[model samples]
Target: MDSQNSMRWLNVIANIGVLIGLLSVLFQMKQDQELLRVTLTNDYYTSYITADTSFAGESLPAIWEKALLDPKNLSLKEMRIMESQTFAPINRWINLYRLSEAGIVNESFWKSQVNLDAGYYLGDSYGRAYWEVSKEDWDDGFLPKELRDHIDKTLLNRKLNETLAYY
Candidate 1:
């Protein structure tokens, strides 16, 4: 009878140990997720800074302004530069969107980012022109359908005559 009692106590202790081990693993996973979020946020800002530095040349700003104002007048080389410059931020937004969809990044943060940049990058005339030119390429199964739909909705909702005062 005493041995039966000892076995029951041992079983209870073993179950508690297993429960504690699982909780510890869950706690560690949560910490890792938080660390990943911090690292990704830092990387996003770093990439934004790097993209801005690409326009540091003296002639580039004028070219960009020209691209924004009169895209039709730009030479092929200027058009390519404008396309590359414009795509950088759009690509970052796409990645952030994917991360948000995956639950890796908070949806609120992603929404804030899109709210801040989508108007300038997708709503403005230059942005619209870029999209009109490049959107066919995006339909080749590389971009997710939901993101494409979201971009389309943003374009449809944006004011065509919207202008940035600072530019």
Candidate 2:
């Protein structure tokens, strides 16, 4: 082949190599992003599980049972026990909110979990009293707006559907 034709063919192969390199870098970046998402989700999941299992560690079930029956009737020690139980889950929620703010966790998933938990925990009068007391301990900006709103809605529903006390 003439020198001109040979040079043109070499240039084409070099361009193809550059394109391949760019594509591979893009692929690597996508994989890295996915791995980061999974790692963040796993961290949040571990925190959630720890918060739930903390009840066993703190011996909260008996106290929680009593508090549920009549929060107004709890002694100072029992109130403290309830307060301690409240903090673990709230701390996990704070961590989750931070992760959501950092864009490390999925906002929609966090929102759903927040709503679900609010429905379960704030479904009655005792939980509302516990929250009123325990919430004073949290720093400003710890709970996200979505979670706060969910709690508000749950409490409102509970008030609207008030049932006679069986205590």
Candidate 3:
């Protein structure tokens, strides 16, 4: 072939090689994302199992139940137990929040989990009290914003109702 034809063929080959390289990088990125998602999901399940067993296998559940029923009557030790009970699920929430923020978890899944746990956690007066006290200990943006806003509204509503009840 002439030198001009040879140079044209080389240019086409270089473009094809660049395209192949780009496709390979895209495939690798997709694979990495899938792996990250699976890892996050597995971590979430492990956390859930730990929390489930901790609540079921020992006296922790009973203690927490009693405190939830009569939060005002708890001794210091019982209060501390309640605090730890509260932290268990909240820690899961923080992990899930991190996963969601990183795009490892989808928005719908994260919202469902948050809503489910909030129903259980916010149902108890002691849970609400613990949230109020411990919230400051968490980093400002660590928890999901919607979850924090819901708790803020719930606490405000409780305070308002209490004030009105005094009249």
List clashing residue pairs in candidate 2: none
Candidate with better lDDT, 1 vs 2: 1
What's the alpha carbon RMSD for model 1?
Answer: 2.0
Top-lDDT structure, candidate number? 1
What lDDT would candidate 1 get against the real structure? 0.76
For 8-116, candidate 3 gives per-residue lDDT tens digits of 9999999999999999999999999999899878888798787667655466767766765677888887787667667877777677767777888886676566666
Across 15-123, the per-residue lDDT of candidate 2 in tens digits comes to 9999999999999988887898798778778876776676555557766767666667888987766665555555656666777777777777666666656544544
* lDDT of candidates 1 onward, in order: 0.76, 0.67, 0.71
| lDDT of model number 3 | 0.71
| Candidate 1: tens digits of C-alpha lDDT, residues 30-88 | 99988988899889989888987876578678877786677678888777777777787
Candidate 3, number of clashes:
0
All candidates: TM-score:
0.88, 0.67, 0.78
Best by TM-score: 1
Give the Å error, residue 50, model 2: 2.4
